[model samples]
Target chain A: MKQSHMAFMESGNFLYTLDRFKEVPVLYKGENIKEALQEKIVSTDSSLSIFPYGPSSGGMVESVYFDILTQGERIQKVSFDAGFKNRSIKLSGLSMGDALLRIERMNGVHSAAYSSMFCHIWEKGIAMDIPDQIKYLRVAMMEAERISSHLFVASRLTGGASQNIAHMNILLLREELLRAIASAFGHRYFFGVNRLGGISRPVNINGFQKKIRQISDEYREIFHTLMDSRVFIDRLDRSAIIKGENSSGPAMRASGIKKDGRNLHRYYEGLEFKTITSDGGDALARFMVRSGEIHESASIIEQALLHSGDLKPDPEVNEGSDSFMAGGFMETPSGDASMIIKVRDGKLESTGFMSPSILNMEAFAGSVSGNTFADFLFGYESLGIWVCEMGDFQ
Target chain B: MKAWILRSFRKGIITSKFPGGRNENASPWSTPPVYRKGDQDPYCPVGAISQGKADANRCISCGLCYPNYEPSMDIHGSVSSVSVPALKKSIRIYQIDVGSCGACNLEIGALANPQYDMARLGISFTNTPRHADALLVSGVLTDNMREPLMRAYEAMAEPRVVFAVGACAISGSLLGKAVSDTLRIDVTVPGCPPDPFTIMDAVQKARGVK
Candidate 1:
């Protein structure tokens, strides 16, 4: 297992120290990697032909370029340029509000994760403990977001299987959750909902939690039906197999690794947080882990909803007249996204974050290498790599 | 086949009453902003507000100026130069992401959901710009994607309109230059990421889809 790779290690921006870097670290330089990482892919095999997909295409949720090295059927390897939408967001010299604003926009699919992680790091840095009520509120928002994200992935898998009926149901569930989140937090993606010490707006957790549980039930029914479809299960069951030991998020958990950030977070212990894992490190296993987590997320939300108390927004963050680094990591909907910031003289001197999407993208590239060309989307979507999250700011 | 049909019909109508009137789906913060009170330069990051008039093109819907220039909850999605009067029947869209936070892409993609059912309005997403009637571009202009974004627009045939969807694409919000600065845009969808309803209505308006 890699403690860290040269990709992020040299930058010195990462919060976690690299005790032992992998001897042969995958020096993933974004767009171009196949040439170095896997020599087998760039072969002179007569049957093999390169096909480029995306960066500008329909059916893709975001802009990403995929270079498929294949023999018209089975793929020898796959290389992707997911950094096309990289805005290179550098949050240095911005106020706390501005930085938080930019953080939420980093990955709109899981804005809650980025913001909550920011807030978590900030609170830890300032040496202030978040109130128990605020903690539950934060946890509830994170879980709801996790449910939506997993639903999106499941929907993608079903869509790949051409299970239009099941796919539609999953999208319906996702939309319902989004609306419910908006109703509770005033914003759809929990933007501005999280503050340093408390949630910005008081949430009606009781109603929100019930709606989540109800959605979870409907989601389970749809997932169950999808599982019943042998074709759907077969398409992903033994496809794109990879060892998840080095992967992050559900990709890691799918391989039966019990290393979920929530498993260690003290706040989640009271909520009966458990790391859900599956046996096979295949797309189906990933799907199983996601499905199980959605239900678990609902249960966590239910427990968190018990303390439905109004929380006042924490006051504006004071700047450090004396500059010092303060940062930490938390389990986002994706994986452990760590953030470190230096505040000096009433200004945020600099900021850096390890957005889990980058690591997961690497995981996707590694897993999809030996699999057939057709298994590309299965392995890709299962890892849930938000391409826009790759460059710069976490 | 008969049982499939029966089961499909059993689900009943989940389609929304969009392209007609405002629905209950749009998030309050993601909607357009309208003026409320006196002159207050409450430091909008996007500079969406100037002289107390809120510009939807630049608004990211951050709600920094609450009470003064608050969320309008408007249904309309964008500000377009002109509608393609001939494209009233069916329109093919090719979406290009120059650089995005993923919200605009999701909101734009949301039009395909059962609730929106954009296909019902003769709208479909095409994989290639050659087959597209319009290009829906999201995110700010990133250096890496500039060429691909331009190439996509170039590949489109005549009567092809370009839509800069979201504050990022239209005005760059806080990221960088608007896609409109580089590419000629016919329509601009506001909000950090405009509500799908707003997008649906705007697309209809852009294509002159009665």
Candidate 2:
């Protein structure tokens, strides 16, 4: 055999080779790529643009740069630039409460998760526990946010498949959730709800409970229609495969990672909750994971709502403290989101946020590579990559 | 096929009745603020208040002012008298995110929801800037986004209108720096992120459509 040299790079568990020919059998770190590969190789090239808009990146944010290489119609390589960086410079030097407000806007889609995680971590660092009722309320709101976030992804997926009806239906369900959130939380996007110690305003427990039950039932019906549609499933299935171990959140769960933050969180430990996973790591798998999680989220909300009576209004627990430092972590709709806070003399000295979007960005190119150009949206939406969240992480 | 049609029928018509008059069912985030004699700046999270009155352009509608001051429905710059005759009737908008939190984008998306189907009113979102008669921009213009935004604006034909969609776009809020200095903002839809109904009202007023 004429020895041909090739190199391989790694993303999660998958080793990707840039070589066009398999006969070469790429090498990695002075070892044969084939010998070390636990999973199959993903070959990619980033040359021609597939989308009419070039890269076709729009979901969760306005723009994300995807450089696609195509041989005729089939995609050879897909690489992405994570767009312009939007640092959280405005957040620095603000009071703890003000910083929290800015953090919610860090990524609008992940606002609730960010605020919840910040409050959780801040309290932990400060050595204070939120009331059980407040914990339940926070869980309910986070779940609601998750439902909406997943629905947004599903809507984009269906819309990309040209299934307008399914797309419209999913969007409607999301809108219903938004309406409920606004009615209960006082803001459609759930901003300013989470504060340093606890929630700013009281939640309408009965109203939220009633709204969720109705919406969840409606969502289940709409989701069934989507799943039953052959076109919808066909568009998503096997198109964008993120290996089992390489991803997180719905993407990870879809690939059989039973890693759910709710499972480990103290608040959700007592709640009747189970992580949903799928063996397939494709777009359909991710879609399925999201759908399954929505049902789980609703169930968790109902369970939490049952104990809504235990909730107390925001207490002045250790408020106006001169010096304190804390960190909190929570699972958002996308994946693990966390925050760190340093307060000096009642003013926020500095704070940091790490959203799931940051980790998921690593897999964006790999997920879309080796797939057809038309299926690009399905892959991108399936991953649920929020650009601003990723950009704000540094 | 029958199942599909039946399911569609069950959903019924859910579009909002805007461009006619105010949507009677539309809920203001808070009742219009009744500016009392007391100082109210400390209560607001976004610093939307100046002197005594609430600046609707900067308000996020968190309702923090309600307990202390009576709410007002008066939205500043809600009325746009500058009628772009070229964009009358059917107008296509291209959305560009300079750097938004995602709320403004969703609010713009809400316009297409069943409650506010902006398409039915002859206003639609276009993927390409070339086809757009107006640019619906959200976000605080970041350094990287400014050039892309300007390029998008230039791609549009003559008589283009720029509709700044939120507090970030209008007044640069907390996240945005000053954006109006670079581009001519024809209309500013204020709110932390304006609701879909308010957005439509501003669009209708700008187009001067019947």
Candidate 3:
């Protein structure tokens, strides 16, 4: 009888072995590697294994499994097994509200972005008019979420270099933002806040604005301190290079892409917002981009708050269609997330989600190909790609 | 480095004095759902509440339960009073994500921050289950993850605690029948994703925090 066992390799590799039989390489991304290096692969029957769950991943979702072949301390070939974590998100036959709830769970932290995209797509299919204040509120919520998400990435990147103090400071800032969100909407993750046509409740700007101001001040001080640290800068500089159009969100902005979905939104037409860009296209660049976006997000929130008082109860409109299909694109903290929905006879027929993680994860393999093991960790933390978000597209 | 030290000194104890001091900052989800006059069926989109009884294991904390109800008025949270005999010395936890959406993981991650500072209570997160006294499992337990979860559990020494950390982990939430029902979970912390304070309280309690 042959039995299969999963094995964990050092750094970037995972293997499955058959008992008392030679290891058969489960080839993936096989064409990406050169023909000359294919002969260097080694097959072994017995190898030390660690369960490929969250423990070894430094608290990341255990959804991703990478298989790497290293040659003399350098990663020669890389492949991944991302199938083990796929959660089939079948939206057919469910009502719009229930569908949105399911989509929210696709990525816990990025729920608002997913819900907004889904609702936007569904509403547009029926061509429902949205109030200007509602758009502003959506943008405000996205910016707030952007701040919290970026802080988490920053904390992880800092923590990767053993800077626990810096990690804790950024996490503390993130907690403060989460508290503000909770105080305003009564939920930390912003679930159920983005309803079709308008927000579920009125905006509470004063308290949220005050918290954003304090967070900005504290963030500036702490970020400046982190920037001045030579060790931290050294670890991040020139690591994980995802140049040109290969990246998105801060990663793309860090690589000098001037594109941002906020510019396309009609509500942001008059708001004072600027897309920040960097030339490094490395880990430090991504980190700096996140730092810059904190300030930008804060400014956007301030502007949005100024107009929040003008929001009126959205006019009641019935958005019913016998057969309709609509698509939407929105800029999340990570990147552009696109959602498409098809409705027939007041029920969902099909839906598609293209989360930013798919594009970012594709770029990840190339970024870490030539880097060392330590740089791989830095690259992953800096990219801020959550495996959980990939279910919608995978 | 010097600046960080000075800043840390100035900040002085930012940690929470929880279960002892005022927990005015408890999360909204920490409170149970209440009945209102206008709330009809589907009070919760995920069906966390039914017939005025809230299932903590199924609630995602979307704040749709009682739209008019204010979470700040009432205070409810974990009792923060469990004393495991075997874990009195200290507890090292290992987290496993069977199939999560990342919220629960973040909540657990937040426990390490200064506010919660779980390390002060003799609880720490280990990178391997072999060194762990508790297996902190999150997300809905899918079939593919069952073997690995069992292997992780088997690796730990006897008298190990398995803590189900979120709604999906506790009752599979929306996944329903997809979640496996094998292991006998020792502790169940509920929420769409439980707050860091709640997570801290659960871990502390599991480690015999008085």
Which candidate tops DockQ?
Answer: 1
lDDT of 2 by residue, B150-204 (tens): 6677788877888888888887777656456457688888776676777888888
Error of 1 at B104 (Å): 0.7
CA error at residue A252 for candidate 1, angstroms: 0.3
lDDT of 2: 0.70
Kindly list the per-residue Cα lDDT of model 1 for residues A1-394, writing each as its tens digit. Answer: 1122234234443212222111112322333444633555445556766677776776778888776667768865567666566787778777677788888888877888788877776666667677787788888888999999999999899998888878887888899899998777767777667655666554655478779988999888777767778889988987777684677888888888878888777668677856799989999999999999999999998888786454555554453444556887778777777778877653578887787878877677767766777788888888887887776772
* Highest lDDT model number: 1
**Taking the candidates in order, what DockQ does each have?**
0.46, 0.25, 0.45
True-contact fraction per candidate equals: 0.65, 0.30, 0.43
Tell me the spans in candidate 1 whose CA falls farther than 4 Å from its real position: A1-45, A310-322, B1-11, B37-39
lDDT score, candidate 3: 0.72
Show model 3 residue runs off by greater than 4 Å: A1-56, A59-62, A201-203, A310-322, A392-394, B36-42, B68-83, B176-180
> Who is ahead in TM-score, 2 or 3?
3
Docking quality of model 2: it rates as acceptable
Deviation in Å, model 3, residue B159 alpha carbon: 1.4
Proportion of native contacts in model 2? 0.30
